[model samples]
Target: MLERNALTFNPGRDQDAQPVGSFTDVRELQQELQGHGIQFLAEADEGTTGPASFIVVDPDGNPVIVDQHV
Candidate 1:
């Protein structure tokens, strides 16, 4: 079966998945989602072990984090 926003396909499995890899694109994604009112939570640093990150509340107020480190 197919899934909306699915980033992975498991031929032998029943469901698809979206892994951290899906968020690895830092620049383009930032621009694309800007219209959605994305907010910055943190900036990326070379000394840091992971990519820059941010947190935004969804329509339901659930925290959604976007990180591009992979």
Candidate 2:
């Protein structure tokens, strides 16, 4: 479902470092969604950081992107 699209997570491992705000493209948005989700709970357990923490889905149901900015 959500995995098939481009999913991006900012600050990657540095969630705490990410500034509190919502943004669309380079500009800022009105609301802030300060939360997180899991793609593969198993990998998350092993501590996968960088782009791996994020998950994007391909047309077929496979993860196309582990991380992306924007």
Highest TM-score model number: 1
- Per-candidate RMSD vs. true structure? 9.6, 10.6
What are the lDDT figures for the candidates, one per model?
A: 0.44, 0.33
- Candidate 1 lDDT over 1-70, as tens digits, reads 5322312212212234334333334444555567677664443343454345544455554555555534
In angstroms, give how far residue 69 of model 1 lies from its true place.
2.0
Q: How high a TM-score does candidate 1 get?
A: 0.42
Instruction: Give the per-residue lDDT of model 2 (tens digit) for 10-65.
Output: 53234665544543321111012112332331222123222223333434666533
Error of 1 at 28 (Å): 1.7
| Per-residue lDDT value at 50 in model 2 | 22
Question: Worst lDDT window (10 residues) for model 2?
Answer: 25-34
State the displacement of the C-alpha of residue 70, model 1, in Å, after optimal TM-score superposition.
Answer: 2.7
Supply the global lDDT for candidate 1: 0.44
TM-score of each: 0.42, 0.20
